[model samples]
Every structure is written in structure tokens, then in C-alpha cells.
Target: MKKTVILGTLLLGLALGGNAQTKTPVGSIGKNDPKAKAILDGVSTKLKSLKSLVANFVLKVEGGNSKVTDSQKGTVYVKGQKYKVLMGDREIISDNKTSWTYSKDVNEVQINNVDQSGQSMTPAKLFTNFYDKDYLYRLIGETTEKGKVLQNIELTPVDKSKNIFKAQVDVDKKAQTIVRMKIFEKNGNKMSYEISSIQPNATVADAMFTFDAKKYPGVEVVDLR
Candidate 1:
């Protein structure tokens, strides 16, 4: 489903320390301009303070007759080498090495390595290094970021042919926080997730990031191994 891509990619952006809603203008970077490098350098720094975050997402969809929509509230915990996402009946857990997605409805969990490379907008590894040689970046106009006027940053998939979702990330120059994000699918469906509230360096439970099948009785695992 296109909506799933939007959702998955949105989560991917979280791992990248980038936003998909605000598009930063790239008119300034070209050929061999140093301004381009400067902009990315700033993005690298802004992305470092990010440790843990929790957000609520609202998903809406409408078509001819079948209308599907839902809102998911979840918390994302990231500490040193661990990450966990708890959303309704879906849970994604990773220990900076292995990753797994568990769905309560189906009682199945899919597992994968945390490499996150070339799997779409999921650049979890890139979080530690905000630069992906293939993605392009530039500063757009400033609107409102983290309650202050900051520089807007835009990122585009360099290898468009394999791009997962076109993104626009709004970054607060002063607060160094990503305020809003918009993700557009290659199929023309647009999904936007805004950071209504952001809490940084929040204490995250260590156990939540691990998958303990014993914790959920009868829950099965689907090894995408």
C-alpha cells in the first residue's frame, strides 16, 4: 500500500535525523559551491543533539467508496546503540545490530538487520553521519522551527530511480530541531507527519528496545531473515 510506504518511510526519516515536510531550497548549491558543503555541515551538527523522541501520527485516506484512516500515537526511544518504536499494535525493535517488526493483529514479526542501506528512506546508519553521498541538500526559507526562526533544509534522493519517498524536511536553525515533515510517494499519495511536540534526551526504558517473545504469549515471529 502506498500509505504503508509513507508510514514506513516516515519512520525511516526519523532514523536519518531528517524531516520530510519542509523542502529546503537548493538553488544555492551547484557545481563546486562551498555553500552546499556548509549547509550540510550545519545539518550534521543539528542532527547530533538528537537522542530520543516521541510523536503522534495521524493517517488519513479517502477514495471512491472505501475510506481508510487511522491515527497512531507512539514513542521512539534511542540510546547509544538501541532503538525501539511502540505504535499501537505494531512494535519495531532494534539493538543497533538486529531489527524486528511485530504486529499484534497478525501475531507475526519480521526480522531484518539494522544495516538500513538502500532499503528506502530508512537511513538509520546515516543518523550517525547525516551525509549520504547520494542525497542532495540545500537551505530553503525559514518559517518556524522549534519555536524560533531557523534555516529550512531540504533533502532529495540522489538516485531518484530507487528513491522511496520524495521528502521535505523543516529544520529550526536555532533549536536544531526538525519541526515538520512531508513525504510524497512515487505513486502520487502524499502523507505528512508533523512534530506536534518534541522531547529530547528523555529517559527511555532499556527493556522496551528488545524483543522478548516470552513477553507476549502466542506472538509468532516471521523471519525475513
Candidate 2:
């Protein structure tokens, strides 16, 4: 269950992830849909203005036969480079320097130092110019869901070696926010995140990003930092 929760979080980032620190020239990237770029840029602009965010979402995992194997509700808090994700029986917290993965079922917490050297996407980067160079995206037309019209965009990774082959993002046209994200892996596993609610510019404290052992009395600490 620990591994499943961690992998779910990683895939969640990929479903709404991007690395903006490194610059990839526009011209160097392959041809993309202009309409999709416009919508995505608008989302990035709106999200960049937020100082902090709290979001609730539902994660649905499907197997090779397209059967819903698992479903979980999760919440994410993001402020700058700090983030905390809670899904089912586990919670992952990071303060940009240190990270703690706590498993409530087993009463264990694994600590590790944040790897600044890697290109892995952080939760905060999901709102930046994440789709600019990493993927070739195109508008997949609009659909009406729950009375709101949503624009769908399909994204294919620029690098072919990635485990994720493609992803689809559904953006609420009027709200200019992501409504849903579906990721397709090479192994035929599908994971989708449906945004339930979002609180932009929420009042968040710095202390929320770090884990306090006191909160979980009997948790065994496995510090690998």
C-alpha cells in the first residue's frame, strides 16, 4: 500500500506535471496545436498568480481491460516549492529540503532529503509553463460535463522512452482551470485525476509542509536523509 500510494503521487504529478527550470526553445519542439497552447497558457497565467492552493481530487486507476481497479480521494496543498499530498492511508509531505512519507496503516514514516538534482516535477510546477516544451499537445475539442463546457487537450511526450505515452487534460473554458487529467501508460495502465474543488490563494502556513513525529505517536521513523 505504501508503494501504491507513492506511485500514485508520482503519476499524479506526471498527469499535471512539467519542469520549468530548464529552458527548451520553442522552435526546437515539434509542431503543436496553437489553440491548445492558448488555453494552457491561460491556465498557467492564472495559476501563477496564486500564492498558495488547496485542491481536492479523486483518483481512478484502471487496468489493462479498462476496469476500475482502484479509486481514492486525495487532497494536495501547494505553496512555492513545498507540498503535502494525502491519499487514502498515506501522506507525503515535503518542504523543498526534506520529505516525509507517512503510512498510517503501518504507523511508519520514511524520511529523505529532497533531490534538487533531478528533473522530477514538483506539485507547484503543475501550474507553470509545464506543457511548453515537454509534450506536443493539441486541442481535442470541447465537451459538456455537469453543465460546464470543457476544452480537452491531448498531450504526447516529446521523449518516447517515458513510461507515460500520453495524457489528456480537460480545462474548464470559463474558469480557465483544469477539471480533469487522464494519463495513459505504456503498460496499459490508466490513471485519471478528477478535480473536485480548488481553493486558490489559501492561507497556508510554512509548518504544514513538514511532518512532526508528535502527530503520529507510535510511528517508526526510518530516516534515510
Model 2, global lDDT: 0.77
Quote the positional error of residue 183 for candidate 1 in Å.
1.4
RMSD of 2: 6.6
Please provide, for model 2 over 1-225, each residue's C-alpha lDDT reduced to its tens digit, 9 standing for 90 to 100. Answer: 234333333323213333122222333246898888999999889988889999888888889898889888888898987898888898888898998899999999999888776445667667677678678988866777667777778888888987888888878889998887888888998887887778889999999999999988988999997
RMSD of each: 5.5, 6.6
Model 2, residue 161: displacement in angstroms?
A: 1.6
lDDT of model 1 at residue 43? 56
Q: Which ranges in model 1 have alpha carbons more than 4 Å from their true place?
A: 1-40, 46-70, 116-126, 144-147, 163-165
- Candidate 2, which segments miss by more than 4 Å at Cα? 1-29
Clash totals for all models, in order?
12, 0
Report lDDT (Cα) of residue 199, candidate 2.
Answer: 88
